[model samples]
Target: MRSVLDRGLALYRQGEDLPAEELAKCTALAVQLAERGERIAPLLHAWDVGCSVAVAACWVSARPGEQSELVSLTQWSSVGVKEITAAISLAYVHAQKQAGLDTSRRVLADLMLNGSATDELAAAAHHSPAKEYVAVAGRVVGENVPSAATVARASAALTTGDLGLSCQAGRHLCILAPIRSHRSTEELSGHMVETLKRVGITFAAPAGAVIAPRSELAMAVQQASRIESLAGIAGLDGKTVESSQVISELAISRDGEYRRQLISLIDPIVEAPELLKTLRTLYLMDLDRSRTARRLNVARRTLTYRLERIEQLTGINPVRTRGILAFVLALAARDLDLSSSVPEGV
Candidate 1:
């Protein structure tokens, strides 16, 4: 959240409207936040603070001759202020929760996103949730995320037909759904899938775990994320992925030596977000250039340009079978290394 605030501040300081993609990310954050939290006053406050600071930035970025108009002393009219403030408020609200439980969610999100716990904060939230629950780690993405109220309605089946708490975990929405001890993993996965489908929310197949005690939430969440490597079990993308299946990918992902090597190899392309996304989609489309281009809605020439640039940057010809395998492995490593990586200072 602080990072999001900083980004808003930087954009505001530049006197630029928030980019549509960035706004969307913030909006998605808000939707997931809505899953467990109920209010967003703090987020609002943070945004307001960013806006206020951005206004002051005019004093610094403005040239001597342009100072009067940009600064406007007392400002005859509140011209751009209202629009900027509204944008900040709305976008921040989209990423915010209802009101309380901010700290609890923050701690949990940090642990899930980074894969380590903040002892003091985690301890406080630890005792609060159910003791025997299942952890579901996966993401829900798109322009129109379901409303918080709508998501709450869906949590019924997710929380073991009882209650569950879904919170933000980096790029994923990790839910700790409470379940009866007797419930089997198959029954649990079925319940989760049915609930999400009913809500009209299409999500990546989740990595799930039947958590024994509430205190081990951090570990459960980590295991859940790693389970995503179990691609064989996933009949489709938007289904639940269980831990019992991810033997190979999980094993390879755990090797720190290989992970770093892949990171180094992939970093050249991954460093460029657009290229990385293109490469990922291409890999998903089974290295079919025409299909990938169509999916990306780009012309064949443009796709070629991007792919050639990627090969140049990564020094690996993605057109080859070996190169394609490398691309796939690199992406998996990145998912494990950067996205849901071990927590900083862990």
Candidate 2:
């Protein structure tokens, strides 16, 4: 089998033609391994090692000082490695079917990794690649990490009809659900939080966003993960936030220069702790002057005076519509650690 792989690789290097028989043998080997309950990772690793050896030998056996031939070998071997891996994947899927094993997990993994797989396999898994999905991800904090059964039970409890697949990787749990089924991502997020709480697991700061399509579940998961991180930075723990609500803040959270520039909006009054507190409280109170004043233990008139002073110092009103947006973003950027010491009197 190893010799077969080497021969196929060499033939490809020499003539850019992959031998059909060699690929068939690889497929057969993968099927056999799958049927025997052997993992595909080790088999793939062995194939990788075999490819490395063949490539090295080909390079060494090149004619003396044959730089062009060596370069060609490198390129061809790279292509061979990918083709062989794909072949193995298809073969393993075939083996799973022949053995009457559930291939849904494998199908999901393939989609997550490559964003696409054979349409037939996807159909078998009931995960149509053409459909759109919403990805909800949350960080599982504390020692009581939910077990696989716990995760499944919680997911089943929260979702109905077509339940999307849930993947738990270490401290992170991501679920990709059909968009049509779950119209409101926030509702889905709330369901997740509630169900997780019932399982003795604290789902901290779950975040969600609509992804492009079922094939892009991985990207959606990544987006949800980023949202969760941003929520944490903003001290929004135990809250379920949709990306759309904080899209601008999320964008600013990514760029250091933008964060610094936005945070600088409040630099003029950073030294005045009282004014800063007032501004933060105003926003937190949803710009309700009466509530903000009560929270700050100040009279409404005092709160009014602080807002005027804030506008005078920073040139941006903390209560007006446009000014409110800018100040909120600046506060978010600062909370995300874009802090700098503005001179005391600036």
Name the candidate that leads on TM-score.
2
- Deviation in Å, model 2, residue 29 alpha carbon: 10
Tens-place lDDT digits, model 2, residues 1-346: 5777677766755675777887788889878876875556556656668878877887777787887877877887787667677667777777877897654454344345344345555555555444776666676665334455555554554444444555553346766665666346666556656665776656655454456576566666666766766666666644477777667767776687998998899999999999999999988888888999999999999989999999999988777899998998888888776433111110
Runs off by more than 4 Å, candidate 2: 1-7, 11-111, 116-130, 141-160, 169-171, 180-202, 233-240, 338-346
TM-score of 1: 0.40
Report the alpha-carbon TM-score of model 2 versus the true structure: 0.64
lDDT of all the models against the reference?
A: 0.57, 0.67
How would you encode candidate 1's per-residue C-alpha lDDT over 217-332 as one tens digit per residue? 66677667556434423233435666555544565566889878876877877668878888888877887889999999999898899989988988898878888878777777
Candidate 2, lDDT over the whole model = 0.67
> Candidate 2, which ten residues in sequence have the lowest lDDT sum?
337-346
Score residue 345 of candidate 2 by CA lDDT: 15
The regions of model 1 sitting more than 4 angstroms off are: 1-188, 195-222, 225-236, 244-249, 270-274, 305-309, 340-346
